[model samples]
Target: MRVLVVEDELPLAKLIRQGLIADGLLCDVAIKGEDALWMADATPYDVVCLDVNLPGIDGFETCRRLRASGVATPILMLTARDAVEDRISGLDTGADDYLVKPFDFGELLARLRALTRRPAAAGGTEIVVGDLVLDPVTHRVTRGGTAIELSVKEVQILEVFMRRRGEVLSRLQILEGAWDNGYENRSNVVDVYIRLLREKIDRPFGVTTLKTVRGAGYRLDEA
Candidate 1:
């Protein structure tokens, strides 16, 4: 997914961005709190990897402002401050999750998945629309009783559509949710992937669930 990394340390920020990119996420870096606030306001990000100890405003204030500004995107605080008070402060300042420094990348990824995962419409892990079912945790999709194998990005994009259901999600929104911060692709990658997804998920069935919104974006309908 697309993420914004807010850290004062240039090396750390670069490292995090590169790592996230390797994981199929688009990432943007912000070395200052003001820039973080502005970037967050201008762009839609699925998650923001924030560091607590920063110059000027600090991560806490930036997070607090983001929440105050009604940016509901998930925030994961990564910092060197591992004390009880530090974590409490981070949570209190509007971080959805917190991770201390010297953490496993695997754990961080797991946490990020938890943040992006959408709850079932009926309120569970298994999201169902008609005979189709998707398990966010397992990244599995099934139709009736037959399993459909999908690539990682395909699953992620499908999850975004399934989560919103009837709403028309623009290309920009889809890109933000399915990529990382500084995604600079000017190609029709979204359309290409959507076509690929349609071939795998829609063509086999007589039911038409995915629809383009005519210059707007795409929507998912349960049949």
Candidate 2:
């Protein structure tokens, strides 16, 4: 799953991004609410981890504007205060859940999972394409009942393809979906990763579900 973490505390934001990445989730950091708004508009994030204290707009106003613009992405507001009023205000402003500061990492991860499972979320907890299966929450991938070992990036790329199976995706499209703005777009990283993915998900099983479209890009289909 892809996530947008909006927090003015640069150190804390990096820590959160690291934790999310370690759990096989693609994450992007936005230090300001204004930046968060545009990033959310440009990217299809599965969830947003919004901090109540920000440099501009704060979390409440940010959440309100997101809803006003019709961005229904699940939001988990983070705050240093545990006041009931803050919680209520966050919920009233369109936050699906709230996490208090100095929180346990495990709980944060669990809350994110719960938010994404809600009815309003775009995709389900698990995705299946033919014999291939992926559990976004558990970060597990299996083909024909056999477990497939994949790096964090491989999993992210595979998730993107499986989520949009049968659609032709160019290198730029895949890069944008699986990576954050931190990555240099000029590199041939997408092709390298796609080759690595095929080695495990296809060659070993004698299946060619991932196809290369000449003059186009790539497509993931049932073998």
lDDT of 1 by residue, 64-177 (tens): 999999988899999988899989999999999999998888898888877776423347678787777888667789877688989888988888888789899989888877
Which has the greatest lDDT? 2
Mark the regions of model 1 whose C-alpha exceeds 4 Å error after superposition: 24-26, 41-46, 72-74, 114-122, 167-173, 212-217
Q: Per-prediction count of colliding residue pairs? A: 11, 0
Model 1 lDDT, residue 94, Cα? 93
Sliding window of 10 residues with minimal summed lDDT for model 2: 117-126
TM-score of each: 0.77, 0.93
lDDT of 2 by residue, 1-223 (tens): 8899999999999999999888878899999999999999988889999999998699999999999999999999999989999999999999999999999999999999888888635756778999999886667899999999988888889988998999999999999888877778876889899999999999999999999999899999997
Runs of candidate 2 with Cα error greater than 4 angstroms are 120-124
Q: Relative to the unseen true structure, what is the C-alpha lDDT of residue 179 in candidate 1, on a scale of 0 to 100?
A: 66
Sequence-dependent TM-score of model 1: 0.77
